[model samples]
Target: MQKPKYKRVVLKLSGEALAGDQGYGISHEIINSIAKQVVEVVKLGVEVAIVVGGGNIWRGVAGSARGMDRATADYMGMLATVINALALQDALEKLGIETRVMSAIEMKEIAEPYIRRRAIRHLEKGRVVIFAAGTGNPYFSTDTAAALRSAEIEAEVILMAKKVDGVYDSDPLKNPNAKKFTDLEYIEVLNKGLGVMDSTATSLCMDNKIPIIVFDLTKNGNILRAVMGEEIGTYVGR
Candidate 1:
């Protein structure tokens, strides 16, 4: 058997991905499919920490009043991430994978508080850890949260799963001439201003020397393929 390239990874899943075809809320079929893939990676001895976005539930900033405070809106977004965290926790456990939900915001009844050392311990013990609440601060994205957790946990890479196959020079949906990049250096992504992730998220990975593999999560087995470091998607690294 071939050795997996990475021993540990952080997966950043957008809430919309959890919605599946409905485009809203938790879809059991989608969650089950994702859980199964995660189980396969864990079986390979790859520790996984996941950071989930809240776009499907709500983006408070998108609904904030013109006079509303940005911090307040961001707080709402954090709660949305918590909702996603709980849903993922349930799904993973249903798949018989020991899972832990750690929140940046304190929610003692529902999950554990975000403690870096404790999270690392869980991964070492073969438990899946889900990180939620977006850095516990406003004005940050879940992408940044995933980067931060990956650095703290000493993860080998960041698996940035999306709805698309890979990053393109132009929106492939809008332009047929769009070209896909199979690989990229951090500087290339920054220089080109590609939307592989937010600028803040991209910079964090670049500074930490953590590569990101962007691929379509909806495609079966892509998560395990990424963890094995196969040539499946555009890799942005230094």
Candidate 2:
């Protein structure tokens, strides 16, 4: 059997990706499609861990702008991630994939509390682990959680699955002439404010020397393509 490019990876999914064209909440069809694509990569013997965002259901920053308490709003955002996590777990399990939902918060009835050793063990056993609750702290985005978990699990790379084709100099949807970058350095992302991920997440990954691949989640098989080391999206590193 051919070996995959990366032995272990963390797939960072935005809540908007789960919303598909609806623009709000979860889309069962879209989630199922993503799960199918993930199964393809899992079959390649890649250790898969996912960190999903909660922007679709709720955004903490948006809430704070509306005068909600900052910490309170962020905590609500964490719960939103748990909801997305459970939905993803359901989609993956229905496809016959052994999946686990590990929460940073203590929600024992629904998920396993985030334990570094337990999460690694789950990956070692070939079970897909979905990390929820965003590091169990307020003011931290799920992007940060993905970076944090990737470091903890020693994942080779972070697969940043986005709705856009890849990172563009400007919004591709808004700017017809926006330049697309095939690759970038982490400092460029920060200095240029490219918004590949938040500053903290980008900094964390940079400090840890973990490469990130930003690809379009709208396309089927992109996950597999990323895991196979194919040139699919913007590559960020060094």
Candidate 3:
């Protein structure tokens, strides 16, 4: 077996990635596929932490644009992330992988409240820790949560699993001639206004000097590949 380049990593999964082709809700097949891939990485002895988004169920910004209270909408969006986290936890557990769903918001009934030490301990013990509900605050994207958690846990990198294969100059789906970048510097990502991640998330990672690998989650075994340093996606760092 090949050794993994990163001993510890934060895997960021957008809710839309969990939605799969349905484009609006969770898909069992897709979740199962993701769970299986995660198992592969776990078997490689890599410590895995995940930050899940809620765009599939709700988007705080979208709701606020339609006149909803911004904070209220964002809180609702946070709740949606918890839902996704539970679903993923269930999937991972079914595959015999020990998983914990940690929420930023206090929801003791279903998940443990976010405790940095506890989360890191879980990773050290070979358990998968899933971070949900963003940073438990409004106006912060889950991408920011991923960056924050990665820094806290001292993760080697952030694996941003997206629908697209990697970062591009334009939406590859819409622009046939869009240019795909093999690698990028943090300044370029911000200066060019690339959609790799939100500015806040990008800046946080840059400040922490954490590298990010943006790759397609739809592909089987891609997670393992990324962790194994396969160079299959856009590498963003200093």
- Please list the Cα RMSD from the true structure of every candidate, rounded to 1 decimal place: 1.2, 0.7, 0.6
Compute the lDDT for candidate 3. Answer: 0.96
Evaluated at residue 88, the lDDT of candidate 2 is: 99
Per-candidate clashes come to 0, 0, 0
Give the winner by lDDT: 3
Model 2 scores a C-alpha lDDT of: 0.95
Candidate 1 colliding pairs: none
Ranking by lDDT: 3, 2, 1
Model 1: per-residue Cα lDDT over 143-181, one tens digit each: 889989999999999998898899999999899999999
Query: lDDT by residue for model 2 over 1-238, one digit each (tens)?
Result: 6678999999999999999999999999989999999999888889999999998999999999999999999999999999999999999999899999999999899999999999999999999999999989998899999999999999999999998988999999999999999999999999999999999999999999999999999988899989998999999998
- Predictions in order: lDDT: 0.90, 0.95, 0.96
Q: Select the stronger candidate by lDDT from 2 and 3.
A: 3
- What is the total number of backbone clashes in candidate 2? 0
State which candidate has the highest TM-score: 3
Q: Report the C-alpha lDDT of model 3 over 10-57, residue by residue, as the tens digit.
A: 999999999999998899999999999999999989999999999999
* TM-score of decoy 3: 0.99
Q: 213 in model 3: Cα distance from truth in Å?
A: 0.2
1 against 3, candidate with superior lDDT: 3
